[model samples]
Target: MSEEIKVQLTATPGEKPDSQKLGFGKYFTDHMFVMDYHKDKGWHDPRIVPYAPIVMDPAAMVFHYGQAVFEGMKAYLTDSGKVLLFRPDQNMQRLNCSNDRLGIPEIDGDFVIHAIKTLIEIDKSWIPTEKGTSLYIRPFIIATEPCLGVRSSYTYQLIVILSPVGAYYSGGLEPVKINVESDYTRAVRGGIGFAKAAGNYAASIKAQENAKKDGFSQVLWLDAIEKKYIEEVGSMNIFFKIGGKVITPAINGSILKGVTRSSVIALLQEWGVPVEERKLSIDEIFEASQQGLLEEVFGTGTAAVISPVGELHWKEHTMKINEGKIGELSQKLYDTITGLQSGNLPDTRNWTITF
Candidate 1:
């Protein structure tokens, strides 16, 4: 390991995938950024090396107790050959937030961004340039300490990898049907639900799989205690428009602080659209839909950017939002965010950084 980011070029690079059919996260770049940490010495020995499988102890804390955190981001290739990243700073910042929640040592957000940008530059040619494709950046930290105790690990490893991903959903920008989860809970108010912890996603697999079996694209979660108040939809933060007012769940301890969610909120507020972040209940959403006030519903996150919810199935009721069509707001948001990401729209908000 090197004290600084010492780059090791790979002897053989992978063949680039077809841009048109590059499904999500199937292809990876040749190099990755890695760093290690110890309790006595703190975080040290940062380096960029050829991507390879990591050997870990059987009793590694991450495998045993799941003390790990990760961040999801992307790099886009414009028609002019310019590479742009959408809010890399926010992703790094949120990674630290997840670290704090999971009892992992916080990382320097600046250093993480630098390592990510350098890795992207080294594999810049792997970025896809189809109608809807980009290089997916995944930065994660795992506890490497070989312990079985129910406490934080004393050692850690940080790794950043690049994947050439197409659409996160097969529908692309099409609206999706969501099934509300009734049995399982994603996270509790006092849990690591607000953080991007690995266990949070791991715990959601059963419910998500059930939803898929029932012919739904994703699952909508409610509060853990009462299990009635709206929380989130699968991996994304959800939003709705009722009577022309944009509303999303308030940033409670259970909701992950989404970068794209924040951007959408800011854009709506700046554009003078009535936007509110509060505890919105499913009953209220259904009432609004029944009364013809539910104008739109969408989910925001790094992977999909904007996923319109055309239909929602709760308990015994199925509500169609925006007549099962993509709402005007959803379309506009998808166009705007993806436009700025690809340099098709001017980044007036300074959210995109050209690399």
Candidate 2:
């Protein structure tokens, strides 16, 4: 990989969507980062080009074999007009992990970060200054070899696209209701569950759609084998506070190791709050609620940061957490993370990178 990247500006700039109406992943910036890969060339021709449709063969391997992975991150605009990225290095590292699992060639995380910063600088005006609004960056790689054979593709394309997005919650933080899914399994042990592969999400859409029909915001997935132990939500990793201790399911090759999940754990440890990462059962959570030990329940991810779980609907049970309200610790973690991201608070942990 070379440090020199070609830049191509757009001739006609696209109209920027209204910041207030910018929903999640709905709008794009004026430019994007792209780099091609071949078995002989490794990865080359890194360039920042105008945002447009990518021309790929109809018989592309990605359309047949589903060898694709993506990473999600955000760039925040500070009150002082500085642009900050929250733990982008972690996202790049995770992308490589996913690539290894999917048999795709690994990318240079550092160089990719540089490319992303360059792309963001070109489209910096699309970053929203509204509270809780930021520019979302999605970097993905797809198999481009036009072959029907069931094997790894030698040709690939890595593209980074930017989207201006509003906050997950337009108003204040509101706790959401999650439906416990038992029939549909999201992933199994020794599977591609931990990787951020595109197919993993496609498999979860049915359960998520069913849960939404039941009036739930998201589906809480259980382990694929027993379907009893809690795994994660469809879009976020889950956590629970019981008896003054915070517990989340351990990463055992079946759960996606979320960057925000690790950050939340670090924040809890910094505050001297007891936190554990191990196998947690939904029955145990219900029992904790029965014993009045359940204090708070929340989900953590790049999109929402922290989503307090106000209610959980299991079979023949409806557990209302924190009296169906946001807990104190959940609120504190959200404020601290957002404060660091928005440059409102001191960066004691050095979690943000500014350009």
Best lDDT goes to which candidate? 2
Cα lDDT of model 1 by residue, 1-355, tens digit = 2257889999988888887778887889999999999999888988899999999999999998889899999999887887898998998889888998889998888888888888999999998777778899999999999989899999999999999998766556788999989999999988999999999999999999999999999999999988888999999999999998999999999999999999999999988999999999999998998899999999999999999999999999999988899999999999899888989999888798886
Off by over 4 Å in 1: 1-3, 169-172
What is candidate 1's TM-score against the reference?
0.97
Judged by TM-score, which candidate is best? 2
Q: Which runs in model 2 stand beyond 4 Å of their true positions?
A: none
lDDT of each: 0.91, 0.95
Q: Could you give me the TM-score of model 2 versus the true structure?
A: 0.99
Q: Model 2 over residues 1-355: C-alpha lDDT tens digits?
A: 6759999999999999998999899999999999999999899999999999999999999999999999999999888888899999899999999999999999999999999999999999999989989999999999999999999999999999999999999987999999999899888888999999999999999999999899999999999888889999877999999999999999999899999999999999999999999999989999999999999999999999999999999998999999999999999999999999999998988789999
RMSD of each: 1.5, 0.7
